[model samples]
Target: MSEIPVTPLLDTVDTPSDLRKLDQSQLRQLADELRAEMISAVGTTGGHLGSGLGVVELTTAIHYVFDTPRDRVIWDVGHQAYPHKILTGRRSRIRTLRQGGGLSGFTKRSESEYDPFGAAHSSTSISAALGFAVANKIAGKPGKAIAVIGDGAMSAGMAYEAMNNAEQAGNRLIVILNDNDMSIAPPVGGLSSYLARIVSSREFLSIRELARKLARKLPKALHSAARKTDSFARGMAMGGTLFEELGFYYVGPIDGHDLEHLIPVLENVRDAAEGPCLIHVVTTKGKGYGPAEESADKYHGVQKFDVITGAQAKAPPGPPSYTSVFAKALIAEGERDPTICAITAAMPGGTGVDSFGAAFPDRSFDVGIAEQHAVTFAAGLAAQGMRPFCAIYSTFLQRAYDQVVHDVAIQNLPVRFAIDRAGLVGADGATHAGSFDVTYLASLPNFVVMAAADEAELVNMVHTCAMHDSGPIAVRYPRGNGTGVALPEVPELLEIGKGRIVRQGKKVAILSLGTRLAEALKAADILDAKGLSTTVADLRFAKPLDVELIRKLLISHEVAVTVEEASIGGLGAHVLTMASDEGLIDGGLKLRTLRLPDVFQDHDKPELQYKEAGLDAESIVETVLKALRMNSVGVVEEVRA
Candidate 1:
């Protein structure tokens, strides 16, 4: 383990209640100590570093100023809530971040009461906080709901939608916009700090309330003009016209790192008898740590590292990540065709659209944290002569399901959906897992769904998607580096709805989809060693099942198993449905489907997750053996080597 940082003040505080016991003057030391402890903890555990570091003082201030648990505080996208977690009595498990049976990478309600509303996806805090505040109000409870949301999260429409309906929450709802990336206003300084403090003060709000009452007694025209003037003055001084329009009493552009500035303003907002308020707090992404401050993205998500040198552990050199291969393949396709374009929902780097954007700036679009818009935009592009590839994570693509169904699938538009993270993502846990894309996309009409078994297959699929113009098509691939297979120099445009047989055998047939093909091959080898000739088929397309091939395999093989790195309703379900439709199950053929379990899987190593899901080689072999034992055909007599 790395040397743990000394945090004298932080050691005294087991929870936010203990934190509130200290004198106001001692908070600076507490904040400093808290920041150091967080850095140390994240250094050991290797989770989200930059985001959590950015909100140290803000976390401290919110806990100090507000009565938490009673006054619920929800952190948007919760990746930045590590410091919040530390303050809220999870410090002991802080080092176990993102590990199996450990602290989750994001906020989880089951983890603590401090996390009133759990979140992993962006732009959901405001809406959730509004729900809490409204529920409390209905119950006649004395509590506030504070939402600390990043400015980047504000790019999504859901945040604004919640803000628009926040008037009913009254003084119970508070939104602190943590502006780390987008500088929506001038830099925070003495003037901005003074303005934030003054505007959020009780006296100022009282005076404004009196003026509003006075204006109500005036003529309709005068009252309207008075309201406009008040809005204009605030808009000019603080640049909160947009938020003001959304029915929030906007405050700040305050320095989030400054404990003194944040505490008083937050206290004022807490006590203010107004409708829902929006406070814009500006802070650096990597606020305090030297290494993180210097290179934000590198330290954003890291591996266990040397704390002193800020050197992260590096994985051994291996094959390129599936994301990179897809990017390169997309770029190659773009070079061949001018109409080919790309779109991503604020995850350019994660989805490999960053490389595409760099290669063809005009043809690529980073549509912010708006997956719905990205899908529809791609649909629009496809409706025209241009072919648009909407590259999004499987988890996030859920946000645009309505658009996928209504706009793309229904219209039969030729939008290519490059779905990344299509299976269990180890550290990110259940919320970030891509376990349902195959099921969801395959179920849609006018949609062709495919999954890549390896890097070369991914290249071919990308080429296939590029050339495909029949309707909405998607290719799903898992996270992390590919299986070290040599990538094709020239990508092949695979035939739609077709699968290839990898090995030929007689008794047992393994139907594999996505990255589970390697495990299927291993299972086949194990079965072959046991004198059971096993056939391994990489059924690339989850939808449009290769009827002839599947029927032939089922009729020829005594036992057939379908495996996928997805949920129960995906490839397995589809294969079962096809078998039933074709009356292939009546011939005394034993069949089984291996997929992710019905329950939501927790954060763990991908291999362990797959094993637990019974999608690993050993699990596959066990499943096949179990199936054979249950068979009445006496296959045990033919098992001799």
Candidate 2:
């Protein structure tokens, strides 16, 4: 093992309780050490760097001031909880973040009592914290719920919804709006401690009480006038607040980097609030580190990088990634059709819409973190006879299911759904995995759900969606690189409900959907080697269900199998339903479906996750051999061995 760097101040602290024991004056040094330690940990095991760095001082302040584990400190998105994890007795295993059997990248209730709510999806912290606050109020428990949410995360409607209902949660709720995007956390040239002390001082409250008492003695007309003047003055002075309208007492846009301001402000909010309070702490996204500070988004989610230079380790160059393929393909189609447009929900870069946005800036819309609005907005564009490709990660697309069902699918609009990250995404675990999109979308009427087998197929799918103006269509693809297949000079539009056979044989048939076609072919090769004639078919559309092609495969072959990178009730389920309805199962025909397990899986390498789910080449072979009751080379043993 490499030598761990000496962190004297950080090493002295094991938990938030230990942090509380230190004097107020020593907190700045502690926060400094904490930031260094968090950077070091993330450098070792790459995860969210900028967010965690941005909140180092705030995390330290919250822990130092609040009685956590009892008083729930719910972190929104948990992207900024690396420092919180280090101070909460998970320091020893912090280096194993996002790895198999390691500490999770996000907060989890199972991981620690301190993490009262588990979160990876944004805009959920305020709602979860409100729940804790209300539950504590009912139980008469001493639990204060503090939700530390980023300003970017506040774009989601759920945050505003929670804030609207916050009064019911009583005064035990605190929301620290980490406004890091605006680069507002500037250093206070020595007056920080004095200003913070003045706010937290008892004289401030005495002045408030005295003013209220003096106001009560004034005549009714004068009192009303004074109250109006005070509200107006406060609004003018504080610039007003939407959260205040929602019943929260608005506080500063203070320097989050300043420990003097953070400690006293947090102390004041902890004691003074009899209703929900929102403290807008403005900080830089990537604070302290020169590289991270210089390039905020680049360091937001980094891989293993050089600590000194901040140069991330790049993956070996290969075929173009699925995301790039979709982007380029969409760009080509958009070049041909002026009506084509792109939309994303706070993930312009992640969904590969950045290039499209550049090419057609007028047509591309990045609806910041608002999935529901993105879906309905795309539907509106489609209704106006425009080809709107709403590109969203499958996991995030789930958030707009109601809109998809009601506004798009039900209305039968021509909205094209470019569903990226359509399978288990490594290092993000089950919450971020795109497992259920097929089930949800396939079940919807008038929705055509298709998945690409490789880069070439993805191009065709993009063109197909662009040309087809019948109803809503979805094209799902995996996260990483595609098979090194040669690109077609020009993409051809695929038939709506189609399955193309890559290999033709007899005895057994392996039907695949999405990127699992390669694995199905590999399984077919194994079956052929075992003296069993096998066929491989790429069932492109999960929803349309190529009934005729499926019947041909089922009738021609004694054994049939459906392989998909989706959960139950997807392609396989649809096939089974089609086959059963057609009475194809009455004969001695064997059928099987291979899919992701029902349980939520933890983060690991993509290959390992596929292997674990029994969706890999070897697993396909094993499943086929087991279904046939053939002891040819003992499939499972040979693969496992």
Candidate 3:
């Protein structure tokens, strides 16, 4: 085990109150200690590292300057909030992050009062902070709302929408644009810091306010010209012309790492009687750590690691991840079809669209953090006689539901949706879990939804989706590695809405969907030992139910169970609705549906999560036995080989 870094300055600070008690000169040391502690804690627990390290000084300055809990500070996306968490009385449990029954990796409202709003997804802090600021204004309160948003998150339209409506906050809303990536402005230096200080100072703001008052008396045309002149001059000095036009007093392009630069600048913005302020602070991701600074992704998300060597623990070699398989298959498909193009929304690497993009740069599109635009863009591409595959995580696809329904589904476009991370994500918890895609997408008209049981099935499904040009089609696959099945050399275009029986029996029938097929097979072995002949069927499509196969199995078998890895209103709900509509339940059918629970699940190991959700083999056997009215277990020494 690696030794934890010494954090004597951090040890004394229990919360932001303790941080505020320290002298201004002591803050630099505090920030260093905070950075070291964050790296050490993340080294043990393994969560987001780069973003948090980037914002160490910024986090300290904000908490020190603002009266937090009373003054709401919302960290956008919350990947950079680990340092914030440590400063807000969570340092002791920081090492337990992302573990089952431990601290959450992102900011959670339930965890502490410091976290006014919880966030895991990107591009939400500005809107949430606006809400907080408006509520305080309406109540005639003294609290300010500060939103610390990254430049990457700014690509989303929602951030601009919030900024456009920010004038109403009236000196209560502060937006700190953490410019870690995408250097939107010239390099920050002494001159830029001096300019930031000058613009944000109370005297300069008061003079500007007087000038604005004096200009109002002039002709409308001159008044408008005067306003543009002031904005344009500042825009030239600092790269914030767009922000100035959006009704914000823009002040920055300052060094985010320097406490001297950040503290007074934040204090100035906090005290200035402006309508709203946008502070552009520049910092490097993985600023302090050498390994992270030198790495390509800046050691963005890491596993439990050695602090001294900066070496992460690697999992034993196994089957390729579902994401990699999908990427390879998409690349293969793109090679065959010239019209086939791939699209992703700010998740090229996560969804494996980066590989596809590398193969065919002209045909690939990585529209930043804009899921809605990505879907509509794919729809447009499909309409223009091009085959477009929108590769996105299932959880993120929820953001573009309106586009999916209005643009693709309504028009019946042949756009293919490659939904990745189709089920529970172990460390990211409920916010990232792809629990509702099947329910949402499968419910839409002119949409065909399919789930892959394994890597081979995923390959076949990708081929089917590529050939599917009648209407919108989607294929969902899980996050981690696939079951070690042989990949087919030639991809097969499977018959739509058809299911295959992996094993045949008479007494018990298990209808499985997605990755739960393995559990179903395992349950079959257990049932067979109990002298109950069991059957397992992998029903690939969720929207177009395998009517003939499902009906045949239901009528023939005494006990039938539908198993899927989705939430309520997914495959299980659809199956029940079908049985009810077809009068298949009139004969007192002993049918059961197994799926994710109604409530949100917490972060845990994948196997434990499945076990807790009652989607494991033992749970399947128990559900089957309960349905069969078998109260007592009958153990048999001799089992079928």
Candidate 4:
């Protein structure tokens, strides 16, 4: 085991109450200890490191200044709440962060009383804090709601909507804008810090308000002049005047790293009787660690690493990842076609669109954190006869369903949807898992939904969607590496709404979808060894349902089973509905469906998560035996074979 970091001050603090017991002068040392502790814990556990490191001092200051548990502190996105976790009595288990039976990567309301609200998605903190504030006001409670939102999250419209409505809880709702975004980082050059001080000062706000009121009372002709003068002056004075106009008493552009600055400002904000205050505290994404600070991304997320050398431990190299395959495939198609372009929602790198961007910078569009706009923008591009592939993680794509339905599907635009992370993503937990995309997308008319069983299939799907001009088509692939299948030099475009039988049999057949084909094949082997002839078919298109192939299998095989990586309403449901409608299953053939369990499975190793979800080979074999009522064979023993 590695050497655990020494933190004398941090060791004394079990909770925020323990932190508040110390003098204000001791906070700097405490913050140093806290940051060190967080680094060490993340070094061992390997989760979100940079975001939490950026907020160490801010976390310390907030916990020390405010009475938490009583006063709700909701962390936006919750990846940056590790320091808060360390301070809030969960320090003992901090080393187990993001492990199967340990602490979650993000905030969970069940984890501790300190976490008043749970969050994994972005831009939800402000709205949740507003809800808490309004509830407290109605109940006449003494609690105050504080929302710590990041600058990148500010790009989403939901945050602004919450801010606009926060005027009702004057002084009760506090928004701390953690400005770590390189785009929105503090203004560069010419005494920016000094200007921030001047703007945050009482005099500047008073003068700005006086000017606004005077302009309102002035003649319409002169009102425009006054407004322009005020805008120019305020823009020159403070960068946060835009937030002020949106119904927040804006403060700061303050230094987030300095405990001296953060502590005092936080204390004042807590004591003030102001409603809906937004404090813009500028912070570096990776504050203390040398390698993280030096890196372009600040090492936002990392695997387990060497703390001293900052060298991350690499996983054993295998096949090219599904994301890389998708990128390469997209780039190949883009090279062939001039009209092909790509759009991503804030995550150019995560969705592998950055590779495409590198090749086709003129055509690639990164629309920031706005998924809603990304969908509609792709629809517009497609409507104009351009083939626009909108690549987004499946979980994140849920935010733009309205746009997908109303803008893309309704209009039958040929916008291609590349949904990455389309299954149970480990470590990040259920919030990040892409479980419902097939269910939701397959139901939409004029929308073609497909899930890839391997990297080769993913390439075929990509090529197929690129050529597809009939309607909006989506291809969802899992989070990790491919299944080591040999890649085609140029992918063969698959016929839309078609499936292929991988193995042939007579007694029973397994219809597989997504990446579950491998497990089905394994199960087939076990079934063959048990003297039960088994057939397996990979159903590529979830929406179209390859009805002809399904009907033939249902008639030939005495038992039929459907397998998928999604929820109940996905591939299995579609197959069952199609089979029933066609009267293919009325001949008393046994039918079973394998899917993720009804409950939300917690974070674990991917293999273990699959086993728990009953989607593994053993589970499939067991399901087959149970459905067949094969009492003659030792089902459990046959699976062991």
Best by lDDT: 3
lDDT of 4 at 585: 70
- Candidate 3, residues 1-641: lDDT per residue as tens digits? 35677888889999999999999999999999999998889998998988999999999999999998899999999999999999999988988899999999989999999999999888999899999999999999999999999938999999999999999888889999999974587677998998899889999999999999999999999999999899888888888899988989899899999888788888988999879899999988888998887873838899988888899999999999999999999999999999989999988999989999999999999999999999999999999999999999999999999999999999999999999998899999999999999999989999899999999999999999999999999999999999999999999999999989999999999999999999999999999998899999999999899999999999999999999999999999999999999999999999999999998999999899999999999999998887876743844334338
- TM-scores, one per candidate: 0.98, 0.95, 0.98, 0.94
TM-score order, best first, reads 3, 1, 2, 4
Instruction: Give lDDT for model 1.
Output: 0.92
Candidate 4 residue lDDT tens string, 1-641: 24688888888999999999999899989888888888888889898888888898899888888899899999999979999999999999999998999999999999999999999999999999999999999999997899999938988999988988889887788999998865665444335545555554556556766777788898998998877676556555666667767778766677887776667666666666555788888887778888877873647888898889988888899999999999999999999998999999889989889999999999999998899999999999999989999999999999999999999999999999999999999999999999999999999999899989999999999999999999999999999999999998889888889999999988879999999999999999988898889999998999898999998898888888899999889988998888788886777878898888888889998899999999999888888888776543744333343
How many clashes does the backbone of model 4 have? 3
lDDT values for all models: 0.92, 0.88, 0.92, 0.87
Candidate 4 regions exceeding 4 Å error are 185-234, 296-298, 631-641
Model 4: which residue pairs collide?
A: 170-275, 171-274, 171-275
Per-residue lDDT tens digits for candidate 1, residues 577-601, read: 8889988887777989998999899
Off by over 4 Å in 1: 630-641
Tell me how far the alpha carbon of residue 28 in candidate 2 is from the true structure, in angstroms, after superposition: 1.7
RMSD of each: 2.4, 3.0, 2.9, 3.3
